[model samples]
Target: MTWQSHLIVMPIVLPLVTAAVLLLFDERNRRLKMAINVISVVLQIAIAIELMIMAIEKAPEPMVYLIGDWPAPFGIVLVLDRLAALMLVLTSVLGLASLSFALANWYKASPNFHTIFQLLLMGLNGAFLTGDLFNLFVFFEVMLAASYGLALHGSGVARVKAGMHYIVINLVASSLFLIGVSLIYGVTGTLNMADLAQRIPDVAAQDRMLLETGAAILGIAFLIKAGMWPLNFWLTPTYSAAAAPVAAIFAVMTKVGIYVLLRLSPLMFGISSGASYGFGNHWLYFGGMVTLTFGLIGVVASQAMGRLASYSILVSSGTLLAAIGSGNTAMTAAALFYMVSSTLTIAAFFLLIELVERGQDAAANVLAVTMEAYGDEEDEEEEEEVGTLLPATLAVLGLCFAICAILLIGLPPFSGFIAKFVILSAILNGNHIAPNTAAGIDPSSWVLVGLILLSGLSALIAMTRTGIRTFWASLEGNVPRVLVREIVPVGALLLVCLSLTFAAGPVMRYMEATAHYLHTPEQYIQSVINTPRVGGKTENGK
Candidate 1:
């Protein structure tokens, strides 16, 4: 295959390779690791951009590579479809921004930080790109294992306990994932998703229900990973405890699980034969709805700034999955759009939080310095300092209030608005499912959609209330010095949100087409099975 024939491999390969090289070096070499980190991140971003361009130009043909040159249905395949490509792009953007922020605020001397970070990226990239189910599990493990370290990056009692729970719960979920895979292999005789896509329908009807049960179990595993519902008890505390940069990157982890669900749900469940999801899509639709509502409620009630923001992100995931489980192209596309928008918004928010927290620290230090110099401030001087300090930070908090409001409420001129527009249109009009859903009583998919609208409004109100209290109501202190490192990350997020207003057409189109591919696994199977090459080179030939 020509080099361009497999551009998708670069994102995964570069990070893993860099991690390997970094692992061999001493932890004290901060300068070298930082250089490698910057370089690898830059490359990942470049490759992602290239793949997106290729996807747009090539249309429906995705870039897939068979490891060791084995053909599809037998060998492990790495696919770079629109969804996969989008993930690669989003992952790197988050990674880059977080890395810069960490540089500004974290202890640069920590030996393990660079190695673990690279591995985390490796897991994320692999999880997004892998086509084999077992491989997906493998990548998930790889990522979460690395995540355990990052979660406790700056060791403390709170972080340790939170990370332990986070680790233990995920391990249980991973075990369940393995169980699901075992049951699937036992029933279908294949772990290759494309092959299983064809074989599951042909299984004996006696075992048909069992196959779906396994699929549902598998869906539960991914949902658990996605931080949906009761199984997600570990999310808020874990996210809140991690370092700012780690939290920023961790925001996208749930999305990877959703990406897997979006890829597999249509094949596993639905109206088609051989589907694995049992009791129909209603299970997912309703389950996702509950989680969305619960998550948003939690977001509103929570106060520690990081935890509140993290819960809001979780709520976004639930809403997105609910849209997909509605089982329609329009709905799925809307979900993907929201996925992209939410990722950007959350990353931006967390980075700003770091800046806010840092500024607070700086202001505290400055106050100490002033007090030392003044030999204790007189009441009038204290009053004057209080007045000045409060206004400046209030302005920064005002910025946070505006951005989080846009994300939490799905407000417009932002990307969230674009996503909401598409979803509401799909929900209100009903999708292809409505004509078929009426077979059962009360099959309105729109009922599930209410989960999104109401939660979104609640998140808005809640975030707005917090903003009013923190920024508009009264200020306890002054705004601190902004982190030079984070300014760019925050700037990038707001700018992208602004730009998304204009890029809505193209973004929505890509998402729609991606949803089209996911809804019809036939294209995925055929694309892999029939792809040809010169001298067994494995060219796309799509």
Candidate 2:
């Protein structure tokens, strides 16, 4: 393989290798561990960016690596395409931000923090790159195991309770995952996704029922992880109870489920599937709408900023699921843009909430009481100040909060607005609609449009209330004492969101190309299934 081709596996390998090495280090070696973790994540980000460029320019076709030079259906394979590379970059960015936040004493609070974090990233990268169902399951377990450790880190009674629920729920999902994979493999005689896709159409009629039954079970597992409503009552509480940095890194964890759906749905049940065409799209659409509604309710009802951030994750996931279900190229492209914007925005908010809420409870209580009694705290005298000065910490936190509100509420002059605008416009314009959905800007589209607008309003109201209580209406607000390391990570993440607003054109084009490739998976199928095996030999040893 060429140098560029070799980079395909580095996302998984580099993290696994780093995690193993970090395990050998003493817990007290803080300075060295910090330096190594920083360098490792930075290099991971650099590699991810390079691989994305390669996917876009050097190889639009996936770069497939056959382990041990074995044939396609028999060997373990890693495939890198535009979507996978984009996800890798997203994970690396989140990892870097979360790690920086951890360096502000969260790492020191927990033993083996660096090791577990790296292992989490290793699992995430592996899940994105792996070419088969079994390896995906393996990576899922790796990620869930590390997350179990991280979720309970800096343990408290609340943390322990939430983490237990988190652990139990995911353990059940993993069991369901195993059962589903077993059933599918039993019917298809292959664990490889591409191979399964190729053979699914030819399965015997008696077994096709079993195949879809397995697929449905698998979909339930993914939906649970994605925090779909009804199945996801555990997410908000669990995430809210996690430490700041752990919560931030978890911003990408929900996306892992969305990524699987996006990757496999089309390949496994696309137009080529005949009887199985649009198998799960209907459930995805309705379930996503319901999830979005529940998320909005939670957002409006949330009193704490952490809970708000957690619900925002559900909102983001639901939006993506609905868009994917719609199967509109333009909407899906816009959803991809929104996914990046929302994940970065929420991750920053999680970190920022820790800083902003520091030592401000007394003032927040006073403001809440004042508003409850008088309905408004400001008088004309106080409202007309011309040269009021704000504390530096308060100013920074307020600015961060404002940016987050704009992003969360889909306000103008940010990527969030741009993304939603693109999606709503696509739906209104009737470019495409999913099967069973209404035609020509029908009731379902109208319902989605109304829900999107309402969800933003709900978020806006919630953030407005929270901001006023914490920053504006408070009688004696404390200027949060934030460290440079912590603040910088939050700033960096928000700035990336800002950059997305500026670079929407190029970014949207890339997403459009990605959506195009995803909808038409023939190229991916051919690339994976027909690739030369190990030792440069074809399956027939030609």
State which candidate has the highest lDDT. Answer: 2
- lDDT per model, in order? 0.76, 0.88
lDDT of 1 by residue, 376-493 (tens): 5455643343343346545755676587678658877678777777887777665644433445423455565566677777777677665654454333444657655667777776
Worst lDDT window (10 residues) for model 2?
430-439
Considering summed lDDT, which 10 consecutive residues are worst modelled in model 1? Answer: 381-390
Top-TM-score candidate index: 2
Please give the RMSD to the true structure for each candidate, in Å.
Answer: 5.6, 2.6
Please give the distance, in angstroms, between residue 322's alpha carbon in candidate 1 and its true position after superposition: 1.1
TM-score of candidate 2 against the unseen true structure? 0.95
What TM-score should be assigned to candidate 1?
0.89
TM-score of each: 0.89, 0.95
- Write model 2 residue lDDT over 400-459, tens digit each, in one string: 999999999999899889989988887787454542345345678788888889889999
